[model samples]
Target: MLPASTFVLGGAASGKSEWAEKFIESYDLPMIYLATGQIFDDEVAAKVAKHKNRRDGRWETIEEPLDLAPALASLSEKQAVLIDCATMWLTNHMMQDSDLSTEQDALIEALTACRAPWVIVSNEVGQGIVPENALARQFREAQGRLNIALAQQAGLVVQVVAGLPQSLKGRLP
Candidate 1:
């Protein structure tokens, strides 16, 4: 049987994505990489390419930048889906002036009823100093809230730092 949901959190360049990928790798099920970033420039494009290359043909990619719940709800249980990030997904909604509460509600509901095992990646942004601007502050707050919600959904929660994972919810199962 597939494993329950997982949440991996870390700071920038803290190996969050790599850690999440490794966690998903341990599962023998077909892999699915649910990407949330939108490539707006050459740098972003290069980063996306690097991630694709690192995945090494093991994962089926689903690029969903704005809508994640529907895509998650549509996955097959045979696939272990890795959402390599919540931050970008949140930014996409914030940029569009979408209601965060509704989006988060849908995400939580979908997460509870997803058709497959899910490994979710998200940045730990509240550990740093407070933001200067109002919008930035709001974003941080929203991210914190989302993390908490995701943690509750996940049977396993881990914080990755310098390529090391510290399990928050349960030991590596």
Candidate 2:
């Protein structure tokens, strides 16, 4: 059985979202795709289109760059939601100079209180070489901390690599 909440982590271009989509599709629910990235450039737009094409008409798409907590809270418990990428959400917040701790608190709270079965995707950014720049280091640290917190609260935690999903905390659906 799928848990009330799941945390999916992977590196860039990994099959995290693909795995997530298939995982949730098994639940046989009309799922909501909460996209956090914006199409600000041609490259980004192309990527977004690819993802959209994958989900195509199967999901109710919600475009939210920031304020994930509020967007998540707005949905009914009956609506299954897959937050495609938390990295983007965090980046948006960071770009706006939002208080990270406070935003993370809100996110965790929302996830805990979410009545619907939900899944969130995030990048595992700390596994590679340390960044030389201070800002990059800070971002890496923040992402690591946030992922830890989310994993702790999640009913299931999975890390995908090379299109393979390795369950870290719970069984697959």
Regions of model 2 farther than 4 Å from truth: none
Candidate 1, residues 1-173: lDDT per residue as tens digits?
A: 33578999999999989878878988888899999999999998998898888887778899999888788888888878999889999999999999999999988888888888999999999999999999999999999999999999888899999999999887776
Per-residue alpha-carbon lDDT of model 2 for 2-54, expressed as tens digits?
68889999999999999998888876778999999977799999999899889
TM-score of each: 0.95, 0.96
Q: Candidate 2, after superposition: displacement of residue 115 in Å?
A: 1.5
Q: Which candidate is the best by TM-score?
A: 2
**What CA RMSD would you report for each candidate?**
1.3, 1.0
C-alpha lDDT of residue 100 in model 1: 99
Q: Give all candidates' CA lDDT scores.
A: 0.89, 0.89
